[model samples]
Target: MRVLLVGAGGVGTAVTRIAARRSFLTHMVVADYDLARAEAAVAALGEQGTRFSARRLDASDQDAVRTALVDERCDVLLNATDPRFVMPLFEAALAAGTHYMDMAMSLSAPHATAPYEECGVKLGDEQFAQAAAWEASDRMALVGMGVEPGLSDVFARYAAEELFDEIEEIGVRDGANLTVEGYDFAPSFSIWTTIEECLNPPVVYEKDRGWFTTAPFSEPEVFEFPEGIGPVECVNVEHEEVLLIPRWVDARRVTFKYGLGDDFIAKLKTLHELGLDATAKVAVPGPDGPVQVSPRDVVAACLPDPATLGDRMTGKTCAGTWVKGTKDGSAREVYLYHVVDNEWSMREYGSQAVVWQTALNPVIALELMATGAWKGSGVLGPEALPPRPFLDLLGAYDSPWGLREER
Candidate 1:
């Protein structure tokens, strides 16, 4: 299948590496605003990049993106950009009549008055609003296809189908023991995304109460992660799985928590307090004159790119779903997880653990879509597809998942 990948950052770059090894991909056009970045990603593939090419494109330009989709005759528009560019790429795919997929969903806003108690525009609300449009076109828009929301969501459906007859709670728990050398405050993923999700009021779901907002980092608890990354304190973070899972999987309650340590939390709070996390553009003095720039963008510019930190990174990162329920009149509790060690990932794929893990799922999804193993129209999550085939494919990629009994 011919693909148009819209980002050439770390995750997007790792995607090209993984896709290059697969025979199912015919051609993948890696596009970015910085043409050099896209070219570099493709060039890194060396002899294996015969089927890959690079292009210069802006994700926010819907008409231009649509034109590019049509010009390149791409069957899918794979978005690897930030959440801020979700809608434009989504709409572009709709206009181009191509299947669409994204690692992250659209941005959400807090409730005007009851910011901590009520959700204003929840995650993926904007994409779900256009579900009918996609269905009418017989095209699919799969949002939240990254590791946490993607593989974690798949694990939720798998447990519901194969492990439990009745599920009480499905909580997505994410943690990492990875550390980067020479940097005291470096994130393993996108800092823009990390700030956005952590600062916003987190959302939780209940069968009776529906969805409600809570204070950021609320209801903290320590979760013991498998695969050598032991116990870490986790807290609620506004994540897409909390919004995506309940629609397809049967569960009384749903949540998503991240194991962001105390130092990371404190730094994030300080950014919020100083308004450095704001995405809105403000005037700043430049070499030419006063320039309009986003504070968050400036903050991102100040940090080392996460994609480049693999060589210095150590330890592992885990993404999993913790379920509690009853199966055949017996109580059941399990955590289905996928872990990636930085040293292994860097040696094998020349990419970091967190980014490589996130990149792996979408390529698998794309291959499945090409092979007809997974098929759907309209906006959907990973849970909406057949979980067995996806989990099986993970092993084929040499990144097998695991399950641990909690009780």
Candidate 2:
């Protein structure tokens, strides 16, 4: 199948490599706002059967995206771009009659200034409207197709489907410790997108109802992993799984949590207190004109690029879901997870574990769509699929799902 990938960042590059290795793609085109980045990614792939091409694309430009889809004859459109552009890319893909896939939910632009509550309220109806329209269309669109939002959601569903009779509580944990020699700090994914999630108010699912807001990092807890990786501290972060599991299955309470090393959490707390993670803009004097900047933009510009830290990264990331419920009138717990080492990921794909996990789903989803295993006409997510199909496919790639009963 012909695939047109939007965005050439770390995750995008990882997806491209996997796609080529699978040999499922006949023609592969990588486009980005930065043409040079796209070219670099294409050059690095070095695949024989898949014809690789690079181009410049502004995802917000609907006409340009539509033209590219027609010109490239793209059967599927993979959106690995900024979360802010997800909706626009989806719209373009629908218009062009191509399947769509994305790693995260659509988010607002400009950071560390506007209140997240305000942004969330403003986006509610409009977001649902877009989903409704996509569902009514003939094409398939998958959102939140990354590791945490994507695989984690599937893991939870698997538990609800096969392991538990009545799921009471579900928690998704993402823990990683990535240390690069030179860089003081770096995010696992895009800095701007990370900041958006870190600073936004978390929305957790409530029983027999809808979502309720929680302060970011408000509920901190410690979790113990089986082995290799030790117990790590986690805090609640707004993740899509928290919102999706309730809709897909019968769960009483659902929440998404993330764990960073103590050092990272300390720095994030300091940034939050200083109001540097806001998305709203403030004015400053400039030589050319009045300057407006968001604190997140400044921080993102100052931090070392996450993509550059791959060479020095050494560690492992253990992420998955924990489900608690009852079976035959007795309480039971089951955990489904995967552990990925940064060094190993670097050796195989020149990417960190975080990026590797985030990028793998879209390629697998594409293949499934092509074979008609995951094919459907509507906007959906990875959790919307049967757990076995997705789990079996991911297991083939060495990312297997493990289930253990808790005492």
Top-lDDT structure, candidate number: 1
Candidate 1: segments with Cα more than 4 A from true spot: none
Tell me the TM-score of each prediction against the true structure.
0.99, 0.92
TM-score between candidate 2 and the true structure: 0.92
What TM-score number comes out for model 1? 0.99
Report how far residue 277 has shifted in candidate 2, in Å: 1.8
**What does candidate 2's lDDT look like per residue over 151-182, in tens digits?**
88888878877888998899998776556786
* Clashing pairs counted in every model: 0, 9
Q: What tens-digit string does per-residue lDDT give for candidate 1 at 221-300?
A: 99999988999999999999999999999999999999998999999999999999999999999899999999999999
Q: Which lDDT values do the candidates have, in the order given? A: 0.96, 0.78
